[model samples]
Target: MHIEVSGLYKKFGDFQAVTDVNFEIEKGQLIGLLGPSGGGKTSILRMLAGLESVDKGDIVFHGKRVNDLPPQERGIGFVFQNYALFKHMTVEGNIAFGLEVKKWSKAKIKDRVAELVELTGLSGFEKRYPHQLSGGQRQRVAFARALAPEPQLLLLDEPFAAIDAKIRHELRSWLRDMIDRLGITSIFVTHDQDEAIEVADQIMIINKGRLEQKGTPWEIYKNPQSPFVAEFIGESTIVEDASSLRGFGNASDWPGTKALIRPEYVEVGKPSDFKLLSATESGRVRHVHFRGSEWLVEVEVGSTRLVTYRSLEKEIVHPGDEVQVLIHRAYLFNNNDSWIMENKLKEDPMPVHI
Candidate 1:
C-alpha cells in the first residue's frame, strides 16, 4: 500500500503531540518511525491505523483519503508493543481469533492457523498459553496473529521492545526477512537506532513532535541536515570549539565553531601508526572498555572528550598514555547552516605544522 501523509497534526487537549508532519511510503517498502518517547511516533502510527483522529491533515492510501475511515475498514493489521495476546487462548486460538471475527469457515481457520504456526515456528506450541511461552515465542504468536488477517498494511509499535536484547536482535532479522517474503507494506516504531538502521528500508526521524529528517540509514548518518539528527542518529560527540582540533581549519570557517564527530571519524593510536604523524593531535587516553571484539577507548584532547574504537589485535594503550589522534571528518553545524569539515591533511597529505 502506498501512503501519503500531508500537513498531519494532532493534539491531546492543550498538549500538541504531533506537528505538521509529512511523508510518503511506496508499496511494499518497510519504513521505520524512529524517535524518542512522546515524540508522536505512536500517535502517527495510530492515526494511520484509524485509532486516532487527525486534527488537521490528509492520510491518503493509494490516492484515497482514509481520515474518516474506521480502524477495521482501513485494511491494516496492528501489533502493539506489549504483545496483546489473550491469556486464556492457546496459540492456535489466538492466531484464529481474527479469522473467526471475520467469520471464516472452521476448516479454513484451521488451515490458516496451521500455516501460520508453521511459518512462525510455533508448530508444536499450538496448545500453549501466553504465560506458558517465552517472550520471544509469545512475540511470534502476536506477529502470527497480526498476519493472519492478511491485511494490505502492517503496523508494529515497538514489536521487539518487550524481548531480551539477544532475542530482540534475532527477531529484528526475522521480522525483516518475513516482511520481505510476504511483501507487506510495514511501518514499525522504534527508539533503537540499531534496529531502525538494520531493518528499515527508509527511516523517518521524529523529534519534538516534528519531522526532523527522513532518509535511508546511510544518508542520514553520513549527511545529517540538522544538529538534532547528528547527535541522535549515532555515537557522536559534539565539540563546542572544534577549531581547537588540528587540521579542522579556523573557528570562523564553521557555522558556530561546533562540530559533531562519530567514533569512526576519529582514529587514535601510537605516533608511528600514522603517515601524517605531524598532522595528528596529542591526546591522553582516559578510559578503555572491552566491547567483545574491539576496545572502546576514550581520549581527552584539549577540554573535549572523544571516543574511538581500537582493534584488539593492535597494541593496547593504557590510561594517561599520550597518543596520536586524527579526525578524518566532522559534521559542523549551527541553527542556520550545516556542513562537513574534512581534515585538511586528507586533501593535502602534507604534514601540518600545528
Candidate 2:
C-alpha cells in the first residue's frame, strides 16, 4: 500500500526496457498500467513485485525502501495472464498452496481456503481440477490462490487476457467490484485501452519505455498531453493542414500543426437536419459498416477521412452519397504539446488562438 516508484530504470543487455518511470499509488487504489507491447508496462510491474532488479532508482512501499526486498518478502500477490494453475492440483489445493508453503496449521489453511473459495465464487467447484474448470473459473482459482496469503498489494498482468471476449467483459466488472470490497491496493498491466478505462481508478500510459502520461481515464481521453496519447486512446483520425477545415483557426495562430478528430466529436447527417450548418463541411460517404448497435460511417472530406457513428434512428446513407459533416471539436497537437480546438462557430466567434 502507498507505493511510490522513483527514477525507475531497467534494461536487458542492449535494450532499455523501462526508463526513469515514476509514479505513486495510494492505498486501496486500483491502477492500470496501460501501453502497447514491450512498452515497459510488465517490466515496471515486475520491478514493483520485486521479481526484477532495478537498474536504477527506488521502490518505496509505505515509505520503506523495497528495492532490495526479495519477491517473497515484498508481500505482493501476483496473478499472471495464463492463470498459471497447477494442473495436478484441485481448486482447493491450489488455493491453499501459498498458505501451505507458509507452514500455516492444517485447520487454519482449510478455513482460509474455504473462505477464498466462497469469496472467488468457486465454492462448489473446489473439488474440480484445472482442466475440469472453464477458463473464467480457472482464473478465479488463480486469483484465489494469490489472495490466500493476504498480501498488501495485488498485481495482475493482463488478468483477463486468456478469457474470451464475453467472459472478459463480464469479469471486468466482477474483478473491479471484488477488489473494491477487499480494499487491496492493486496494479494491473493491460494493452487493451477499453479494459483499462473500464476497470482502473487511474491509468498510467507507458510508451517506448517511458511514462507518457498518468491520469483518470476521462482526463487522459479528453485532454491528451502528447500526440501518441491522442492517437492511442481512442478512435481518432489525424488531419494534416487542419487550418483548412472550416471554423478552425489559421495554422499560424496555433502552435500545433495537426488536429485529431474523435468519432464522438463528429456528426454526420443530411444538410437539412444538421446544426451549425455554417461550420459543417461537405464530405462524400466512403464506406459504411455495421457495429452491432449502430453503423460506422466513413466520410471523406478533401484528402482526410473522418469517421463517425450513425445512430440507428437516422436514415442510412450509402457509400458515395454526399453528406454534411459537422465537427464539434478536435484535439490539436504537435510534437511537444496539444490543445483543444472548439469549432469557432460553436464558440463565442472570437478569433481562434489555439
Candidate 3:
C-alpha cells in the first residue's frame, strides 16, 4: 500500500526526535531509511509502525489516516534487529504465533507456517528452537514469522545487524529477491551506507532529526544537493577556494563558495608525468593504507590533507613521497551549500607511463 508522511514531528519531553519530516513510499517498493545512530531514523520508523505516537502530522496509508490506529490495525509486519523470537517456541510455533493472534483456524495456521518455512528456506528446521539455530537461521525465522500474517507492509529495523558480514551479504540479496517475489512493500532502517545503496530502490538520508536528502543511490551519490549529503554519501575533498587550484579560473565573482572533489576523480603520480602544470599540485604523502584491492593514499598539500584511491595494480607510493595531484572533476557549491555547477576538466590528465 502507498504510504505518505506529511509534516511528521515527534518530541520527547523537551527534545524533538523528528522535525517536520515528509516522504512517500510507492506500493511494493523496497525503500531504506538511512542515517547514523541517534539521528531520528529509528524514531521515524517506530512512528510509522504505530509503536510511537506522532506529536503532529498525518500518516496516510492509501488515503486513510492511520495516526490513531494501532499497529495490528495498520496491517504492518515488523521484524526487529534482535530477531525477538520466542526462545522456548519452535520455529513453526513462532511462525504460527501471528496467525494465532488473529484467530486463524488451526489448519490455516499450519498451512501458512508451512508455506513460510519453505519460502524462507527453513524447510527442515521447523522444530528447531531459536537458541538451537544459527544467527542466519534465527533471522529467517523472524522474517517468516513477520510474513506469515500476510500484512500489507513489512518493516525491518536493521534486520542484518546481528549477522556476520559474510552472511549479511548473502541475506541482503536473498531478502530482496524474496520480497520482490512476494511483491511486499518493505522499508528497512540501516546505518550502513553500502547496505542501503545496494539494497534499497530509494534511500532517505536523515541527520539531526531532519531529512537531508532522498533519492536513488546513483542520484544521491552523483548529484548531492547539500554539503552534508555530499560528504556523508561518499569521500570528498572540500576545496574552500577554486582560484587556489592551478587550472581553475578566477573566482572573484563567486565569493564564499567551495568545491567538492571525489577521490576517484583525482590522479596521483610523479611530477614528471604531468602534462598540464596548471591542474597539478605537489604534496607529501602522509600515510598509505592497503584497502583490500586498492590503496588509500593520504597527502598533505599545504595545510589541507587530500585522500586518493589507487588500484593495487598501479605503482604504490609510500609515506613521505612527494607526489603531484591532478583534479579531473569537481562539484561547486555556493555559500549556502547548494550545488551551483559541475567542473569537468577539458583535458584528461596524461596517464603515468609505468
| Residue 107 error, candidate 2, Å | 1.1
Report residue 90 deviation for candidate 1 (angstroms): 1.7
Report lDDT per candidate.
Answer: 0.92, 0.91, 0.87
**Lowest summed lDDT window (length 10), candidate 1:** 248-257
Q: Which segments of candidate 3 are over 4 A away from where they belong?
A: 240-242, 249-252, 272-275, 340-354
Model 2 bad stretches (over 4 Å) = 254-256, 348-354
List TM-scores for all candidates, in order: 0.96, 0.96, 0.93
User: How would you encode candidate 1's per-residue C-alpha lDDT over 16-101 as one tens digit per residue?
Assistant: 99999999999999999998998999999999999999999999998999999999889999999999999999999999999999
**lDDT of each residue in 79-157, candidate 3, tens digit only:** 9999999999999999999999999999999889989998999988999899999999999999999999999999999
Return the lDDT, model 2, position 345: 76
lDDT of 2 by residue, 1-354 (tens): 999999999999999999998898999999999999989999999999988899999999999999999999999999988988999999999999999999999999999999999898997898899999999999889999999999999999999998999999999999999999999999999999999999999999999999999999999998888888889999989988778777786654765588889999999888897645788889999999999999999999988899999898889999999999888888887666678888887654455578
What TM-score should be assigned to candidate 2?
0.96
Give the candidate number with the greatest lDDT. 1
Clash list (residue pairs), candidate 1 = none
Residue 25 lDDT, candidate 2, scale 0-100: 90
Residue 286 C-alpha lDDT in model 3: 94
Clashes of each: 0, 0, 0
TM-score of 1: 0.96
